[model samples]
Target chain A: QQQVKQSPQSLIVQKGGISIINCAYENTAFDYFPWYQQFPGKGPALLIAIRPDVSEKKEGRFTISFNKSAKQFSLHIMDSQPGDSATYFCAATVWGNTGKLIFGQGTTLQVKP
Target chain B: GAGVSQTPSNKVTEKGKYVELRCDPISGHTALYWYRQSLGQGPEFLIYFQGTGAADDSGLPNDRFFAVRPEGSVSTLKIQRTERGDSAVYLCASSLNGRSSYEQYFGPGTRLTVT
Candidate 1:
């Protein structure tokens, strides 16, 4: 089963605008949720993460809004720039428990200037 | 001192050939993971290792796929009788914790093409 599900297989946003992506998880055991950003020819890198304890987390221009009841979370990029054009993947795992991650299908975002 | 690294960034082999992909994790990291990403899909978990032993191998596709972490710091994934469907980017990751809150650092995946 796909533990996490993501939407918008591809997206196009204008520079200086907001780029948003959403994900849902079915595994209640997942306590740690993280989003990764990947560029062409490179592996993914951690972007932002959130725990169920918090409703939301903001780091710089990136924000992760999580809802425990809804089993949903989203990544928002403020003032999205062309440099932000890349593939984004949302993942869930029960950290300190098992290193296995359930990754979403991924969203290919294009921020146009 | 560095991120995870995968050897033979690209490999092309004939069908039915055997191939092995290697991974080197960051210094001090104790957990390692293997995943495969097809052309347009997200990565699929394959196996996981903690210390020098495998904690999980349920994701492995079949008996033909095997992995080992002899020393716990590095790993190798071996595939026998490679099939065309096996072509994909295989990724390796490392984390400080075997199963907890630490972020997993990824390596530039090795693109394996079985022709």
Candidate 2:
């Protein structure tokens, strides 16, 4: 019930195209959701985050869409570039629970030049 | 300003040996966390500390895994009787104190290889 399942073990997108990754969860208690980007040999960095109060949140070229009813969320990348290629992970945590994150299986995204 | 820094970028040990990994959080950050990431997978939380005491450690895999933050600045994760399955990249992160403290900054991580 604590698991955050992510789809598309790997994705390849062309430059200037749209890239999308999906995730689903069973726990409804999770009020905070965040996406992280990790490059080779680097720790995962927070990219964008959203709370259950809002349906969507956008930060520059990255956007997160959330569906409270479906227990699902997704990350969209506009104008995909090679520099955006990396491993992306979706995570969830119940606020005030020590901020221990439950992460989904990562998605390896490759943007072709 | 420096981000979280971890010592011993890499460590290799034989089965049954013990090892300790260290983390130095950013200055004035009162919250610290430790996580372990296996190859091709996302990280899993291991423990959390607020000040000099461990606030939560339910994510710790077993008694063989222990951590301590005696001075509220640096923390050490100790693994006893290390097994080959224990090999993974151990990550450390820190954030400010508040309800919005979830915005953590992570370190480069220390990769442990148990043979």
Candidate 3:
């Protein structure tokens, strides 16, 4: 079963516009939610993460809004740019799963200039 | 400092052949993980190593898959009698420790094709 589910398999946004990707999970044991950005021929890089205790967390232009009760989390990119075009994956990890991550299917975002 | 590194970025082999993929983790990192990713899909966990021991290996698909981390540094994933269904990009990741919250740095991945 897919523990984590992501929406909008693909996305497109203009420069300076906001881009969003959403993910939902069914496992309540998940405590850590993270987002990863991957470009072609490269490994996924950590973008932003949030714990269940926090409602939201932001760094630079990347933000993660988490809702524990709803078992959902979303990533928001402010002022999306062409360079932001890549694949984004949302992941969830249980505290004692030895850092094993359950990843979403992935979202390919395109930022048009 | 160098990040995680995998050997033979691409490997093509015939079905029923044996193959070994290597991963060199960052210096002093005690946690290592192996994952397999298919085209257009996210990576799936295969195994995890804490130092020289495998703390979790439940994700391994079958007995044909095995991994080892000797000397608490580099690791090798061995597949016996590989099949076409085994074709995928194998990714290796490492962190400072095997903690649940530590960020895992990933390698470029080794693409294995079983024909």
How many pairs of residues collide in each model? 6, 0, 0
lDDT of 1 by residue, A22-64 (tens): 9999888888999999998899899998989999999999999
Q: Return the lDDT, model 3, position B11.
A: 98
Reproduced native contacts, each prediction: 0.84, 0.69, 0.71
The lowest-lDDT stretch of 10 consecutive residues in candidate 2 chain A is A93-102
Best by TM-score: 2
- What is the per-residue lDDT of model 3 for residues A1-113, given as tens digits with 9 covering 90 to 100? 43899988999999999999999999888888989999998888889989999999999999999998989999999999999999999998876669988899999999999
Tens-digit lDDT track of model 3 for B1-115? 8999999899999999999999999998999999999999999999999999999999999999999998999999999999999999999999887684469899999999999
lDDT of each: 0.92, 0.94, 0.93
For candidate 1, the docking band is: medium
Higher-TM-score candidate among 2 and 3?
A: 2
Top-scoring candidate (DockQ): 1
Instruction: Return the TM-score for candidate 2, rounded to 2 decimals.
Output: 0.98
Q: Write the per-residue lDDT of candidate 2 for residues A6-103, one digit (tens) a residue.
A: 98999999999999999999999999999999999998999999999999999999999999999999999999999999999999998877888899
lDDT of 2 by residue, B23-68 (tens): 9999999999999999999999999999988999998999999999
Ranking by TM-score: 2, 3, 1
Predicted candidate 1 versus true structure: per-residue lDDT over B3-102, tens digit per residue = 7999999999999999999999998889999999998788899999998998999999999999999988889999999999999999999988775536
Which docking band does candidate 2 fall into? medium
Q: Candidate 1: RMSD over Cα atoms?
A: 1.0
